[model samples]
Target chain A: MKKIKYILLATIIATIWGCKPEEFGPIVGSEENFLKEMQGTWSLTKVTQVDQNAVSNGWPYKQLDITNIYPYKELVVSFQGDASGKPSTFTITPGNSPKIADLNSGNWSVDNTKAPTVITLTNNGQTSTLTLGSYANLKNGKFYLKREKKVNGKTILVYQYEFTKK
Target chain B: MKKLILSIIFILSATLAFAQVTLSPATFTAEDEVTITLDVTGTPLAGTQDVYIWIFSNSDLPAEIIKKDGLTNGQWTNSADAAKMTKTGTNIFTFKFTGTTLFGQSPAELINFGFLAKTKDGTKQTQDYKPYKFDPLVFVPMQFRVFPSKMDQTDMTTVYFHQDLATDQNLQRMFDVKVNLVFYNDATPVPAVVATRTALVTVKESNILYSYSFIPERLITLTAGTKLTKFTYQFTGSVKDANGANVPVAGPVTEVVYTPFN
Candidate 1:
């Protein structure tokens, strides 16, 4: 009788606890499988780069229009699922800029665990890097990447190459 | 104990009521946030001259003041100066206070409220309003979906509904309110809200809404990876009466469609 009473008490407690409503549902497979999700080739969908130094100086960040940028129109970045599991090549048909004329194939890897995941690419024997929001941000059928560089000692943003997986 | 219970009952009765002040969606849990509005439209409280409202538990109030708190438009001053209610809409003093935050760790199952809406000098005031019950009578769903509304058969798409308490007073008088949501694709009998594959709903970003989500890909699989074009959802809400029988709230049974992919 005592055992039954204890069981009944516990059952009542559990039922009462279950009656509460939940605010947020668990998002399936969020940030858990980082490396496995990086298998496919991702195209640049949208990009926004900002210079923090310029922003603090009361200057607005420049937003690049990917559709109007000639070089971006012909660029295709492919990531291979080969042994090293790195980006295999970056192919871009030369446009107006001389910088696009000599760009070569590069290896790429995304450190998805970092606060702002870093995307590292080696092209033309020179390594270049940028940061992404997260794997979830990437999985949203779009790729967003940005970087900051200085030109003539004037800090500026090199923005907006966001891609989605096909 | 019987006298105390009777006394408490007599206090909440409408007889001692003075100025009318109503707290909407008073039924709340520690996980909930309620917007308590002080409608001081017609009275001397029309002009803002340091008139403020503070909320306290029934235990904190004096026995006599607690008895008189339920009096509508009653001139009551606060015993505790903890929180200052902010002014929101016109002639209305509003404050969105969190349940769990107010109750802290050791909280009562149901918090009995004692309110004071008065000027700093105790000149203008409204009567106190105590809740009749704890469980709210209506659930309003807040709906939203993922970015790529259209996706590959393998790709995941999330459809979300945030369960929220209706601030309207009409629903509050009812009891045992609950909602049942049904999601469907354009031409199939596939159910998007199956328990086996559904994600576990645990918490909310804000205390205002209780969120529930469903995925489209798991509902029906296309053999050739066919692209399904559209989906829609229909939800029905009901509240119970004195006899515990469910009473349906009247609304157009319109099946809201998912917005086309942007």
Candidate 2:
């Protein structure tokens, strides 16, 4: 009888432990959710010109930081999204800066939502592709894009643009 | 003993000041083809039909002296056909040979050499041997190197870019490299706009090294009272990026100080 009582007690303890509910940690957003962070206006923070030839051959001084050389700080760019949270339109307010995008306003679309690599802008039949250089700090309010110039199918220069959320 | 030492010093000084032998292109390295000219005027070997060069080195130490194989082959009695010099003019003989080959040693090993004109019987010869020196061979490989380190603006200066010595990742992988050059004059702090040019960098060694040659005077015309103080240059090329697109690349700005013509 004492053994039976002990068995019943052990069984009761095992049932209670087995019935415990599983717990899960807080959910983190995917790289795709960073896209929504691009909405609203951003100001140009810095500009850099990279010599692709020098960079490729392991030469030093391949990059020239020209943030202060040009009036890029006056430029403000705005990105808008539709109700479905998809890329819609982008507007450029370039006061005295070089026309990096070459368009004042255009419909834009990202190459991928999971990890966007390119942002293609189209207006009236003309299209331009701005390569995504970095989005590591997108949630923290920083983004980078690169504009490349090519000659005879060869990329000769890359102009990098850094934008900070306003 | 003091009188003998003084006599020996005087003889040595007279021998050094002597000018029986003269080499064309007076200054040359051991690897350069040199014409050895011997003037046998007033010497016993003058007007000899077949004159030979008795060449040797390290004359200070008789035990450690080394002679050219051609002279040794003659055994100092019967001159070898190879040792016979060509009679170029009246009482003048010339022999065309490189020091490295004639001495069978490197330029560094041949500290200095002396030679005397002699006959087949070795009985009639010059009063004393004439001494000659070879300039030291110097070459230092770097990412940016200039030949003949000390030079004036008028001299032909060659700039070299050792691709193998490049440390930048972009420079290491770049191709079709060329040099972009610009000169700065004393009048302006900036480089001369007219002197800016892109020049082809010729390959010194396939894929390992490249060089570009230019004379500062030829590259630009300096105004009166102005001189070329320095020149800035960079190596430019093309490279492929991650997207498989060809990208133009340029190296860091390098400046070479100029030595203005006096």
Candidate 3:
């Protein structure tokens, strides 16, 4: 009876150990962190107009700094988040300035959660995509986006926008 | 002996022509501020203590010699302080004025103007009046053009090509054209040149218009104290040879000068 009890106990312990799943490193959760970081108000700081032709030709000066040419400083943008901290609606309040984003409000999304290089905004089935500048560290309180203006599927001009977290 | 006398006369005439009044910017519109320099070495106004300018509209009153209706300076006998010339060097005096402001007329109203240097009392003056014609204020599209007319090293400038204005049949029908550029810093005694850069893509503005824009400082790394004084460019495209193979062709070389930033 004593030998049978020991055999049953060893079998049960082996079965429990065999059923245990493998463990790995912690989850990155980069998308959630970026979405959370972008959910806030941002103010327009600068706007630069880039000549696509000059850039394609490897010219040294493809951009024209026109930050103070218009009333761009009055523009403010807000990126809202849902209850789950996911990217949701995006809004722009252009005070005495042109609607650079083309839409006042729209649903915003990133191309990838892990490495988001592009941000797309959709309004009434019309979508516009902005290339995120390479220097975007969401925690640095600064953001840059490049909007390329195209005609007949050919890029003609690119406008760069810089924003500061308010 | 007769031939020698004729040669002497020709040389004397050339010297007189060289000593006449000259404009700083050979070409200018009425809106530009121009400086006129006069070499009064052989003229009656030479060695004058206080020289003055007497400018008149030659286009408005063709029959009149001295019509000063819109003159900004005081009367010819008593010149205004504004009309006084600054002595730059021996026998050389310079007077700066804007055509529009000097004549108190719009750019459209002015055409040709005549000016002469004289003593303050108007007793001694240049022998003949010097005439200058203003550049057309109207915008007439050309085969090639540069934007803003005035450019600096740090400012963005654009060079444009108009197919409609192209004189060459091949250029008018060109496709996939590109610009070739070379920069030169001629501000110093010896000119510093940047390497020739070809294959600059052009952006199409319309069916017949294209342009390439760039900043000098960004395109070329200038050595310390080097100024971008001038640039030359040409449009290149490919054309079909007799065997139907594509061959490279280039348009006329165009040179543009840069203005100094204040």
| Highest lDDT model number | 3
User: What lDDT does candidate 1 reach at residue A49?
Assistant: 34
Model 3 stretches astray by more than 4 angstroms: A1-166, B1-27, B39-49, B58-78, B121-138, B148-150, B168-170, B174-176, B180-207, B229-232, B236-262
User: Poorest 10 consecutive residues of model 2 chain A by lDDT?
Assistant: A25-34
TM-score of each: 0.31, 0.36, 0.51
True contacts kept of 1: 0.00
lDDT of 2 by residue, B1-262 (tens): 9999999999986775465676643555676567777788778876777898777654454556554443333667877778888998888898877778877887766656677778977888775564577756644346776543433454445667787898898988888888888876655213364467775565555677777766665566766666666677888888998899999998888767653322
Q: What is the lDDT of residue B57 in candidate 2?
A: 57
TM accuracy, model 3: 0.51
Decreasing TM-score order of the candidates: 3, 2, 1
Better of 1 and 3 by lDDT: 3
Winner by TM-score: 3
Fnat per model, in the order shown:
0.00, 0.00, 0.00
Q: Rate the local accuracy (lDDT) of all candidates.
A: 0.45, 0.72, 0.75
Clashes of each: 24, 21, 1
What are the clashing pairs of model 3? Answer: A60-B218
Residue B124, model 3, lDDT: 88
